[model samples]
Target chain A: MSLASLTKDWAATSYGFLDASAKRELRRKMLKAIAVPGCQMPYASREVPMARGWGTGGLQVTLTLVNPASTVKVIDQGADDGVNAASIRRFISRVSGAAETWDTLSASIVQSRHRVPEEVMREDQILVLQVPNPEPLRGVEPNMSIARQMHADADYGKLWLTLYEQIVRKGRIMQGAAYPSMVNGRHVMTPSPIPRWDVPKLNMAKHLTFLSAGREKRLFAVPPFTRVEPLVFSDRPYQVEEHAHLTCRRSGLSGYFMNEIPQDNGGSTFEVSDSNLGIKAIQKAEGAPTEIGETWYRDGEYSA
Target chain B: MLTVAPPDAIELRCNSTFQALMWALSRPGDARVMPEAGLAGIAETLVDLECTVFADTPDLREAVSASGALVTGDVSRADHVFLSSLENAADQIVQLRCGSPLYPDDGATLIVAARHAGQRLRLSGPGIEEPTEISLDAPPAFWAMRAMLCAYPEGFDCFFVDAGSVIGIPRSTKVEVL
Candidate 1:
């Protein structure tokens, strides 16, 4: 073949900020990640404008997936207005000519750091989580090669022992976020630093979730209707944060995950962690038309 | 303001093609429409210089080779395999790579052209909300060989294409001949 047949017309930059080769590599890895639900697939995490640890993994995945028709949303700790979230959202839209939305319901693809939306994600929508650490066994096993062997053997005893020690020392399970969860009965994965309250949203849920860690250079998936069981002893049941009774100081909504603000008086007030959900609640209260989708939690209880 | 390059036609086509493949593989047993009919788009979307691909057709092999991926004659050595028809390649089925437990990503992806209308099969796995049944035109030997070759967490993923419609069956899925 001649050079003309082999080469394309030169462009200033590749679409979505990633070269075609990078996207193809990611596409291959992503397919494998979905094939084995909750199993981390190693990828060449390509460089972006952002830092490696600061949501670059999620950004790459979004860039690979986004198109002009895609409605994109990015969130940092459940707030779309956060600088990190806002910038990522803008960059995606600017590069791809995609529509941007803070409302989870309006988004076709939701990329976030440390939170799933308060609204239930539909089967059609995709959720990409910015994972700081994709490996659930990293805490117990430092050597990655051996850890992969353990994963191959399906030997999760060390993970269980970590939980057991937590109970013995703290009188309860003290591990907060990035809880180790068993996915599809075979693989255990870190659900990406999301709070215990938000973990159940991924269990047998309608939406497909991709968890990617750029620094780690690995990505994994939790497909729709897959089992995501948090590791817990039968004697001590898995417990979520006790935030059901706390009300959001801004919107007066209760029974959802909250962010606590400590006061000078030594008491603390709580606000809804999902900022967009709180905004919608306030708008509805003011008689503005709004639609709040069904949440995983109902009245502070993990009902779904 | 920083000016960004708009997506060229190739980028847009590959992006949409990948989206279809992703959703198709994510939700097995359900049919997803591809940007174009046939497996060429898939090769362009996924296979690159880093990959070793095996294709039954010379046209597809040439297309894959043009992408800079190594064209392998052996199915076992291929990370991606494209077959014009599964019924014609029964002997090649067992040779497909089913990656070991330590690294399941080494498992190959098989894209075969098959009719959507034929013998019914039941699928249940990560993607299926409940047990869903669909029909495919795969031969019985194909099913028997697939079941024998695949071991959970260590099996090749397959995509059945019919014209513009595609259905993915990951190794995680259990296919029961009905």
Candidate 2:
């Protein structure tokens, strides 16, 4: 083959901020990740402008999937206006020319950290979660090689033991976020530090979820309709963060997950953690034309 | 302000092709339309110098080689295998790489040319909300062979291409002949 055939014309920067070969590599790994649901697949984890731990994995996946036609949304800790979320959203839109949106219903791809949207995601939408640690066995087993062997053997007894110990000591399961969940009845995965309330939203849901850890250089997926059962005992049922009775002080919306603001008067007030949902509710109350999609929870109950 | 670089023709094609392939694999048994009507677009979208591909047809082999991938005659060594047809592929199917449990990503991705109509098969697994039935040109023997070879996380994934349409059945999918 001629040398000219091997090379392409020079350009300042590659489209979507990632070279074609990088995207191709990610595509291969992503397909494999989906093929074996919740099984971690190792990738090159190429460097981007941002640091490795701060949503780099999600950014890479987003960049690979983004195009001019895509509408992108980025959220940090369930808030679209967080510094990290806003920066990522703007960066993706700036590099790929994709439209940015805060509303979950309108986004084609949502790159999130620590939370799934309160609204039910459709089949067409993809959720890319920024994972700080993808391994569910890390807390119990420090060594990764043995941990991988345990995963191969589907041995998750230590995780259950830890939960049992917590129950014996605290009288309840103390695990708050990033609960270890069994996917497709085989692999146990950390759903990426999302709250207990949000974890149920992933169980047999319509959307495809990708949990990627850039620093760890691993990625996994939970395909639509896949079972994501949180580890719980037979006697004690799984408990969400008791935010069902809490109400958002600003929007007057209640029954969703809330963020508590500590007051100097030895009390705390609650606001909806999903900032866009509160904004939409306030706008609708103000008589502005706004559309709020159906949520997964209703009347402080996990309905969907 | 810096002006964003627009996507080139190849970028657009690969993007759309991957989108179709991604959604197809995400929801197994669903037919997704591709931008182009052949295996060539898929090769361009997935394989590169990092991959070893096995293509049954000489035309597809040449196309894969042009993309700088190591085109191989041995199916077991290939991470991606493209078959123009699956008429008498018993031996090849047996030799297809189903990766080890430790590193399941090493499993091969089998892409074959097959019609979307024929014998009905039921698919149920991670992707399917309910057990869905669809017709494919592959024989029942093929499904039986697949069931014998695949052992969940350690089996190969597949893509069946027909003109501009493609359907993906991942290793996680359980396919039953009707």
Candidate 3:
């Protein structure tokens, strides 16, 4: 079916247990978050049958933002069927029964993972991110009192010391994941682990962005035209990973990131696979002539 | 990606996922999300962006084909990248195909799954009004590598996914050592 019709169908679904009044309340709360921009506002986030880490925050926002005029696409790790994504899609389908898809561009409401879709999202789209921990200071001090005071006063000289310590003690900077960032030139906000590639996408985008944590029960927003800066030390320097070679193994494709597969005798090395929706390419390359939902695997896990 | 845990390793994934969520939410600028597979997941994780998890897409046969029609490719250009552990994050940082200066945001988002959230940097930036610290229990090998990847305007974004939640730190913000 055409995307337009599919989207039309998707909007018909309900937005979970939220009544019309509740939805309006959520809408009002979200607008409040957006209007203030960069401030955390606690909302009445519901506990879905799904777990805390499985996008309860995003689903709530989707319900609040979704309307008869929207098309929703939900993905986990950029793929629509990555368990969590499937759960959300199924939930929306069950409640709202709105047309659901993996297509990025076609979606007006998208709940995604650390990685954003390959298709660039437009301003019209509202991206909702799922969050677990909302505090950057938790790891640093382990004391909420200290952390709250640190932020209340902007006393981050220790962050520099930590990086310096990495360089001093080990000749390097010492952070791996959950790297810190400064949001809207004032408040530092988590960009919802949407991959570094997607991280920069948040820079100067036309769309309004929202982040929520059902478990934490905190919500924040990045209004249009706001500056989001990732944390960095001048002497240490900020850097993103670059590929020595970009090639996928299974599909014999290039211009795509490769997942290193073991290539040795007993073990192997790094290889690559399609990131998302490569079926179109696969069918063409292998003459596998197929369409969506046609399961052809020998292992027989998929039966669509 | 090879999975040591069963395909049903949902609980373990849950534990690490919360770690990941913390990092992602704490560090607005970083990327943290790991696949169920170990190293295989790490190396091939970025492929998730351009790849699909069809009911049968991982049919090893469908995966290894060169059709580009169903699902197949090289590991150079994916934006949604994955890593086996936060252990390999340092190297992944230097080699993950982060986008150019013009499209810096186009850099691949790397997912590094680890055994646990290690205690490491005390990160303070705009996210923390006063100050904030992040503890990563990534293996010492990870700590042994070049620690800092965040540089103003250029750096690999990261997501540290553990069992419970996720955490992130992109390359755009400034970090201070506590």
Candidate 4:
């Protein structure tokens, strides 16, 4: 290898494509998130190789925090190899030689979609959620400025009235997925579009839960041991509707919130939301279903 | 240390691969099958990806080597670098790009021809309603460099190809994990 040739090769190497100025600002936002403790901070969102609502926020958080020593785990609903999750896995491995794992237990950082894992997350574990739509009042009021004011003054009478009106009109809350909740009794944040069943599970916890919306460029957090109460009234109390017919055949459990399976026929059919995935744990003690049900379409009916 | 574009900088060339991935993961257990022919039906099957790796490049030179193998070119502009010192470019692959932390979904991918592409840690994340499928080799840690990446979005994303089959994990995704 000639000296001249070596010099020429060095000149061609572009170490990083990301602009230096942009990186600095994002780092500042990240630092603010860590310093305030459970505060939602605005940062410059990047257009990743991936799109918005597709774990882009989580990808940004992971990328910003990535060090040579970290182990990465990406999960959507639980299984790691889902297309979105898998694609993220591919990108991280490319930028760095950091290790990857399917096991959520050992994972230092876990990026999730709708459902948080069934297992209890630790205080040290970091949970990054890719929020499709972050505003709780978006569906109710469709105005961002009003919702911000409502949170600022702790005015949630309207949300209560909306739910109360639903009961008075439809006999129940009738909300399917992406049920809303208040974080720290202040920020009325949307906990992604998860099933109503999982909403109860989000009580005070130890882990650091982050919500990121790449398209909206919004980032928020829920720190450890904070109050997370689902707003409900004394009479109605917030009941999570059930799957009328479908149940986890493997686990022999029924009435879980169910997503639908689009049959060849025009109209779709409904099935268990946590279907085959939830069955894995209790199934062995019970047994694997001689049958499995397929369900869901991307970005549909979470907040409705 | 990488610089980012203006929050709305020069429009970023979208990563077609990521869009295609959102589709795949959004509807788990369903394979968005693609054509095997090299760059043949890429447009039809690859609704969100680009075929930019044409033969007309200044530094790229793909050829068969004496070791009856291949090598990933100097790992620079090649963000999604693929490596397999064992096979010809025409033959099967052993490793590919997967993004790492700071860019987990941006690392190189690997397609080790291991006998099995299903084993190791379990994973789960968004874009999955139920248990999605995975095609990985046994004891992902056995790959040493591969297993260590489990921390996330900070490690390399990978796909294991064996016996004409493939399984993927992007940087933002989580493995089913035990």
**Which candidate wins on DockQ?**
2
lDDT of 2 by residue, A148-246 (tens): 999989999999999999999999999999999999999999999999999889999999998899999999999889999999999999999998899
Candidate 3 lDDT at A2 equals 48
Interface RMSD of each: 0.9, 0.7, 16.1, 16.2
Error of 4 at A59 (Å): 1.2
- Which clashing pairs does model 1 show? none
Tens-digit lDDT track of model 1 for A59-113: 9999999988899999999999999999999999988889999999999999999
Expressed as tens digits, the lDDT of each residue in A1-304 for candidate 3 is 3456323232332344454334533543453354334545567777566788778888887765544345788877656767778878767655544567666656777777665554456645767877776666665789866765565455666665665777788765555444566765655566766543355556555555778878777787775445666677665556433333444555544443334566558754443332454544566677765443221121211111
Candidate 2 lDDT, B91-168, residue by residue in tens:
788889999878888899999999999989999998899999999999888888888888887999999999999999
Taking every candidate in turn, the Cα RMSD to the unseen true structure, in Å, is: 0.9, 0.8, 24.2, 18.6
- List, residue by residue over A81-135, the lDDT tens digit for candidate 4: 6788887876765564456866566677777788765455665577778788876
Instruction: Answer with 2 or 3, whichever has the higher lDDT.
Output: 2
DockQ head-to-head 1 vs 4, winner: 1
C-alpha lDDT of candidate 1 relative to the true structure: 0.93
* Model 3 lDDT, residue B159, Cα: 56
Model 2 chain B — which ten-residue stretch has the worst lDDT?
B144-153
Best to worst by TM-score, what's the order?
2, 1, 3, 4
Cα lDDT tens digits for candidate 1, B24-128: 898999899888899998899999999999999899999999999999999989999999997669778889999999999999999999999898999998989
Give me the chain B TM-score of candidate 2: 0.98
The DockQ scores of all candidates, in the order shown, are 0.85, 0.87, 0.01, 0.02
Docking class of 4: incorrect
